[model samples]
Target chain A: MSLINSTATEALDLLAKGQITSVALTSAYLQRIADTDDQIGAFLRVDADAALARAAQIDQRRQAKQPLGKLAGLPVAVKDVLCDSQTQTTCGSQMLASYRPPYDATVVARLKSADAVLLGRTNMDEFAMGGSTENSAFQLTRNPWDLNRTPGGSSGGAAACVAAGMTPLSIGSDTGGSIRQPAGLCGVVGLKPTYGRVSRYGLVAFASSLDQVGPLAANTTDAALLLEAIAGHDTQDATSLDAPVPRFSAEIDRPLTGLRIGVVREHFTTGLDGEIEHAVRRALDVYQSQGATIKEISLPHSKYAVATYYVIAPSEASSNLARYDGVHYGHRTDRAELLDELATEQKELESAGDREALKNIDNGLVRMYRRSRAEGFGPEVKRRIMLGAYALSAGYYDAYYLKGLKVRRLIRQDFDAAFQQVDLIAGPVTAQAAFKLGEMAGDPLAMYLVDLYTVSANLAGLPGISLPCGFTQSGLPIGLQLQAPPLAEDTLLRGARMYEQATEWHKKKVPI
Target chain B: MAITRADVEKVALLARLQLTDGELKMMTTDLSQIVTYVDLLAEVDTEGVEPMAHAVEVSNVFAEDEVRPSLPREQALANAPGRNERGYLVPPVLGG
Candidate 1:
């Protein structure tokens, strides 16, 4: 296979055998990115010189027969939301367009410790707020399968880079299907590990409770390899799980004995694209042939996932985003003169002993805060902040934010009940395949529905994987999602691997 | 409940976002549709359910009070938009 198209596992084998050097592998990926990223828009920045230097160092270490990390000599792309210290992490928003972190995200640090060459940072929705990646303030990441169509977002660039053969592995974050949705739309493997499975120390927070970091790869095995390397406890992230990290790559090939997969009846309801449902059912049939049994199950409260998510995520986002006040860091408006004028007026009022008038005067600092945010963020981000502020505001907190949390509990209960009878729940990753770039523009409600089937996993803090199942009539890829109980990524990867081994769906290549 | 321009303005102030007249109009319509859609949550019976704050059950994750080297002041303030030698510069908070 060409170096650009080789899976991370295959490339590692070649590198270990001394047949291929990390320099060669990294160069091939960088070249491919340079050639295609202009059209695909998968990356915000590519660190070519630094990547080459790192690869050369890895090659030197291997020549000396030194100890190496699991992902040594492999190239990996990370979403721009991750802080790398070496590159600017923008989160695809103007708010941080020029802001550079002084530290690396836990995942980035992990990837580096694994000896994986950092290829570059990929584009994403501003603060991961939107699904289509159209909310990216910098560039539009188009689906590699079809240029005019969107690569499902906010991990759109992460998935597209892998699908377009720019990189063998990429790291993406999932707040609500950001990884899986785009991976499905791009015909690559994407995994959203359980909520606390990966640390989130330097990841730019959108929704603190729902966000997670995971891998996107060409196959389940690569995803497993990347997951094993990054999944562990970090003192920097208090929510990081202290449990033992399993050897996912080693256990991925083990076939389950009498695997019981649950198909949620609510998932196949109206609004799901017929072709996606058909493809998922066909995947279930493939599993049955492998001695796995499919059983009908119910997650009755899943219907409220989108509703609950919009409220809860935004409420958390509103609170989390309050830090970008232009005082500490990030974009600050140039309104010093305005402050000076306000200061002069206040001094005059104070000298006149007009204490009441001084109290009523507009605070220049508050106006600067408003103007800075308005100038910094994109429309979708502004809208979510507005909605979240409204929901969490004094009078509506109980009605909106608290009520959404209560429903979130019910959603988790539904998953807990269903998992009692089944090891994994299988369903379509999205209602439809990749849509036209502008298809859902100007309509945020329709865009929110794209996450209907996938949000429940994040809500319940379960591990979910999206792998290629089939394709639409127009040739866009369809994804089959398998969700496991919290911290059951071992089972999740094995289940995805079983389906992958039995079928040729994952082997399909993008036309790009 | 339908969101009005007044509600959008109020929320915008709370969020510290200055919206133009055009944005206020658009946000009023968009938020109304989204709020109505998310209102579907009210149909579900969540009586007696405790509000879930976090996915996993975790509490009081305290760390040892050990002194460690912190980020250098220069590195910490490297990304500041407006800063002096010691701290960030912002608009006047207490007027004069």
Candidate 2:
């Protein structure tokens, strides 16, 4: 079997047994990426030299009879949203196009410590704003299953890399279903760890309160392995919880006897694609057959998740993104300089009865800030920033932001109540499988609706996982989503493993 | 409530974004549609529900008041689009 096809766990075993060297394994993925990435567009950047160096270092460690890290030679792709000092981290935006951080994200640092080969930065929705990676300013990541369709996003490229067999694992940040939705569409295992489970130190902030970086892997075992490596508290991130990290791989084989799987009634309601709903229901049956009980539960306020998320996420995004003015960092507008020159002309023009010439020139610090941001951010980003600014603006905060907060409480309470009766909730990851590229591009709201099932997990800060369960008639992959109450990743992964083991769905590869 | 073109322009200004007239018109429609959808939240009676800021209830997370290593000046300024010996250079503050 090709090294790319082996799971990270199996590959690590092979590396340890001297059956395969890290250099050889890394070279295979590098070659695969070079050969296939043109069609897939899964990566924003690939550093062949650095990747080989890291792999050679791992092989040297093994040859010297030294202890190796858990992921000694595995090639892992990282979403561009995560910072890596070794490569440029663009967050898929033109604003950060030439920008490179001096430090690696905590997750990236952890992956390196585990001796994993850093494949490259994967494409994402710019600053992880949109559902489809078409929002990416760089390139569209095609679903490996069907080259015409989206890979689902903002972690589209990460999931596509795994689905295309470029890498066995990739890391992605989930903010309103970015990771899981893409994972579902790409037919891979994507886990969004509980909020605060992973450090967000070097993750470019999208919706700070909602974003959590996690693993996207070819299989549940590899997903769990990757999650274990990155999940922990760090002093750098204030929200990162000090909660004890579980050995997720060790708990993967846990039997699902009497596990109460809650099938959320709300998720089965209107707008879910028929094939996806059927596959998820069938997945529930598999769990039922394996001694797990499926119960109908309700997250009554979950209907408000998308709306609440729209208000909350963008509101936070507006505030979080405010730091990107030209003076501090990111793209600076030459318009500011031109405007300054124009202001001088404006004074003379105004005196000469040509006030119209001064319309676009506001030559001050305020002008620099506005002009830089205007040039830097994309349309969707600007739309979100405007929506957030309006929502949090003076007259609307109480009606919009505050009301969204109240509904957020209700959403969390609903999940809290449901967890009392069930260990985990199961549903479809998205309303449909990967949609055709540009399908929902004209309608931003339609794209937001695609995240209906997955956003509730982020709304309530719950851990969620999307595992490939079945496919549509058109052969597009459908994902079954499993969510657990906050900090209940152990239960969430255990439940997903039960379904993953009972079916060979995960073993089915995209014909990339 | 339908977001008007003026409303979008106003929000755009507040967001430090400069939108063209065409973008403003499009944004008006888009924001109106989004607002119409999110307006659904008003239907759910959130009576007595407290506002939630975050998923997990975290009090002020205080690090020890000790100085630690921070990013070196060059590393911190590496991604700056405009910089000089002092720091990131900005447009004139006074327009003088």
Candidate DockQ scores, in order: 0.72, 0.75
Q: Which residue pairs of candidate 1 clash? A: none
Off by over 4 Å in 2: A335-337, A344-361
Quote the TM-score that chain A achieves in each candidate.
0.96, 0.97
TM-score of chain A of 2: 0.97
- Please provide, for model 2 over A1-512, each residue's C-alpha lDDT reduced to its tens digit, 9 standing for 90 to 100: 78888888998889889999989999999999988999999999998999999899889988999887788888899999988888788898988888878998899999999988998889999999988788888888899999999999999999999998899889999999999999999999999999999999999999988999999999888999999999888998998899999998998889767799898888877888888888988998898888888899888888889999999999999999998887767888895465655566677877888666565445566667777787778889988898899899999998899999999999998888998999988889998888899898779998888888888888889999999999999999999889998888888888888888889988987786
TM-score of 2: 0.97
TM-score, candidate 1, is 0.96
Error of 1 at A10 (Å): 1.1
- Across A1-512, the per-residue lDDT of candidate 1 in tens digits comes to 67977788989999999999999999999989988999999999999999999999999999999999999999999999999888898999999998888999999999999999999999999999888899999999999999999999999999999999999999999999999999999999999999999999999999989999999999999999999999999999999999999999999999888899999999988989999999999999999999998999999898899999999998999889999998888888878655765778788999999999888666778878888898999999998898899999998998899999999999999999999999999999999899999999999999998999889888889999999999999999999999999999999999999999999988888886
Which residue ranges in model 1 land beyond 4 Å of their true spot? Answer: A336-361
| Share of true Cα-Cα contacts across chains kept by each model | 0.86, 0.80
